[model samples]
Target: MPRLVIVFDEFAEFKGRHPEESKRLIGIARQGRSLGVHLILATQNIEAAVDPEILQNSTFRICLRVGQAQDSLQMIGIPDAVNLARGRAYFRAQARQQFQGAYCGGPHGKRGESVSPRGIIWVRRDGARREINLPGWADGRGHGEPEPPQYTEAQAIVERIQQAARYLRIRRPALVWPDPLPPRLHLPEILARHFQGGWDGARWSVCRPLRAQARQIAEIQPLIGMCDDPARQQQVLLQLDPERGGHNLLMFGSAGTGKSTLLRTLVSAIAHTRSPDSAHIYVLDFGGSSALKPLESFPHVGAVVTRFEDERVVRLIRFIQDEVSRRDALLRREAVDNYRDLNARRAPSERLPAIFLIIDGFGEFKRLAPAELVRSVGALLGGGVAVGLHVIVSANLQADVPNAIFANIGLRLTFSQADQSEYFRIVGRPSEARLRQDIESPPPPGRGLLRGTPPLEFQAALPSRGDSDEEQATQLSLAAQAMSAAWKGPRPPKIRALPFLVTPTAMVEAAQSVAQTDRADLLVPLGLDFDTLTPLAVDLAEDGPGFLVAGTGPQSGKTTLLRTWVLGLGAQPSHDRLHFLFLDFHTRTLAAFRRLPHQNAYVGSAAGLDKALAALDEEVARRKAQLESMYEAADGDFDSGQVIRGWPHIMVVV
Candidate 1:
């Protein structure tokens, strides 16, 4: 272990202000020698006030120019210091010695030689004095004063010592403090530093394999930011290790504190490190600013849902839940304990990509979302990590986050909080020194304290090269677009959603295809299934002999759904056998269906509606009579399983 040294420049004032600290220093001085810990205490004229214990334990002492002989005697047991000139001091150990301290202010050059009025005088080896006339030296005084010796500043000398130490492979004492973190760290610069190879045109020709795919779990840590360890004098790359640092992350900060920007940078880092097949990102931007909207262009991003997208937000949460369930089943079936094991056993092409679910403005989401949804998120945070599902949630305040959810998250980041109490609550109480330092100088945006083995302070990298939000957003978009265009790997499975508009012709084709494959009594294609993205069809004869198409508000798809059903029915070969009656209260809505050969009657007026109903009743009575006559012909034992081919199915749209 390196030796420790504690220095007190003005011991008298420090002792006056902090009596306890002075006592502690005395204790350290007593035991420090055996423990390789040393203390240097300095005072000008207050040597008599110094603690006797400190003086007794101190192995060496130095006394510079003192005010009185008594002060010199008190310091080094000698009066020599009183007569000492500036830059001169007396050291007292086994014996007293005088020495001149080097000046640390600045360098000094050799003084020019002074000359006599006639010339400079030179003393020859033969003991003969010769006066040499030099124009510049021929002033007045004889071969004047000798030139002063050149002096090197203490700083330069120390620098040279440091250079020599490095060359000699000698270790230096640890720094008392680390350098302050930079105000800004661009993502491109960080990526370039860590990853090998540069852009080959627009594509990154990576020379190093991705950390996500590393064979060892320890080596799979992904870089997030740069961490500053002041005590250790180290500025190391801050990586989130899944094996050691739990998967879920919770970040707390005030608005515009770079919470969203840090999330964006994390996504960008993942994209640069992992292929679309290896990882996927799903963002729920409840922040309302669509801060993560630009990430939608990345091939690795499966979805980016904003606050305005109410349905999409719900769907996105459901999607994540479904993914968890899917991974659970997959791992059980494969006899794997976790995703990492599953990936190791399976081929790269067969591996399931890791899912990163980032919920921005989680406080707002918790407030608006249903209790069940919030609970579902909590459950995900608890068990999702085992299956390669990582959830990162950020909130503006600690109160907005539930303790149940907060406890499950392992990695935590706290940005500039509104108060010291909030910061302490998020990352636990820091040391007094840390509190004093941080409270005096609050961190700026993008600067945060990360909770780990030893809490570290880090500066998050920017997602783009630009400083302004607009420029960063634009640059992020362009980068995403470029990556999407250049990517040759398979993209993440897209979230299934119904198209806004489906043409009647397309519906007809879909229905016809379904009819040829599987014969249903009466199947009509409705639309696409939300979960599977497959064509969804309703088996009218199986699921419902009678069905009602209903919705709230105008143009709520009631008319469109009814029209799609009618069109789909008409596309089937059995359409000729089917009969449709259109009761068009709003004539224009169902007018097109009246031209179909399957249509029995098209009634719009009130008088026509009654007649249409009476005619339909008469037809029902006729069909009943025909079925009864057939039963009588068969000796009252009609074949129950046999199909009645003469009867045509009647469908009504109202």
Candidate 2:
């Protein structure tokens, strides 16, 4: 749509008298660019005709044919543009938009110098446009554009400095300036605004090429050969932002490409950020123990390992679904929706470290006898991310899995795999195609091609040999033991748990050893609970027989329970008074007895519990006495005599 149009309106009133008509023509040419127009006013007038403003904006000006070189100086100064052939005009140093056609050195300009006349321009996209106006050499480093009245003065001086520096490579001693400043510091922030330009040996140089590309913001700190070299390791890493939103990245490389290693370092940097609401990365280690196995003991890791439990798994699924629902609701409610906000609004229930689930060997998920894992993958794709859930599923597929999975798994990392087709499916096509066949040839131990965006935006230091797996394990085990020991402190003479969660104030610790005399005053009926005693209790809340017991606590009626721990179901006259027990220590010196309304009674003891012969001994003795009594009396039913048999005895202690 940018077409060339020249306005000769001011020159229309061509008066030979040379009144003020010339001045008007120059003004129209100078201001036209601001209004989206460019003017080339060709005139054969003197100083009285041209306006200063009009001439200042003229990036190019020339004379078709003038009286003398002096007259040409008015248009181009120093070397008169009019001296050249009629159509072979030379370039003139001018400011502003419009250019008067003139022949120079190169195809665009001269061999030594190239002038864009109207600053410089660059395209962002297919058909986008932008003009660059940079400040001093180090835009906004030391000196910046002044405001209002001072702004005009600053603009003129800056351009003069630029031209002087360009034309004369050495600082122009010819044109002495009242002011001088040091070189500017270069940064992305300084380049986005105004710019500075100068004439170099054969051409002018402008820092901002005005070439449109991606917008970037980085408050870069000084580094030892940092921007120049990215492969070098940096101790302190900071990520520079590209554009406004976060970049979804993909990583593709062979094994030992340091994908997991680099991801760890990046995670460390993110943890050190001062931004309160920054979104954190959730690493999903789907590569067995090798991928995220090391993360099992790391703090701040939301590591989840799969276990075999049909019901428990269902519950976990429900929990994941609920988490997704909650995050979706939060997104809808918040005015400023971003990962940062959702992170801040995390509910107390969601405060279990982070909610990241590192599902190892995702392929194995389908192999397990589960129903429709592929369908479940859909939910994982939809709301898994926003809820602070990140998944790093590993597959040998060259390209990414499916569009849906690929979309959700914005960040991709590929370990070494032979199949290019699979890699293409796992990652994108470009990366897979490039590294597919190459991976099969056996890359160097710790080297491979890299794809996807660079995180940590830097490199991580290699660990020394001293940090080997066995050494690390030993250190960790020692530390855990030390911590546990410290918590336990000195051992008590007796470990005593009470009948309830509360440790009874009545309880006292003994110094040395407490014998049987120590428990002489122990009550007949007592309660055994968590605090005073490490009583094993079943969790009514959980299905199956899940019982927990810790160290010893206060002893109570454990012996009583051990005594009558067995009986046939429904054979007992009293079930409420009965219990079950496994004989270990402390099940001696006690007899349990339960009597019915009749004089006959049911009795059990630790000694009798171990034998069917003992039950037979007691029953046989009673039956023998009953038989003798029946003979002494007459005929009678089995009571304390005859063969009195109700049910067989089941021994629990045995």
Candidate 1 structure lDDT: 0.75
In TM-score terms, candidate 2 sits at: 0.34
For 1-654, candidate 1 gives per-residue lDDT tens digits of: 767888888888777656787898788767768888888888764653475777788778888898788888877887777788999998777777777775677853334433223234676434489876532233321233333333544543354345445545678775677778898998778777766543333665433533445453422344568889876777977666676575778898889888998889889877776666778899989887887887889989999888777667777778888889989998899888898888888787898888999999999898888888888899887678789888889998888898899887878888877677876778776555556666688666788888754567889988878979888888888878888888898887666456677776766666666653333546778886676556778875556668887789887888878877877778666666688898886646888777786656788877788888999899889877877777777864577335454456788778
For all candidates in order, the CA lDDT equals 0.75, 0.39
Top-TM-score structure, candidate number: 1
Q: Please give the distance, in angstroms, between residue 468's alpha carbon in candidate 2 and its true position after superposition.
A: 9.9
Candidate 2: worst 10 consecutive residues by lDDT?
219-228
- For residue 383, model 1's alpha carbon misses the true position, in angstroms, by 2.7
Candidate 1 ranges beyond 4 A from true positions = 1-39, 42-50, 63-101, 108-152, 159-184, 188-215, 229-235, 452-454, 464-475, 495-522, 527-536, 551-561, 571-575, 583-593, 603-642, 645-647
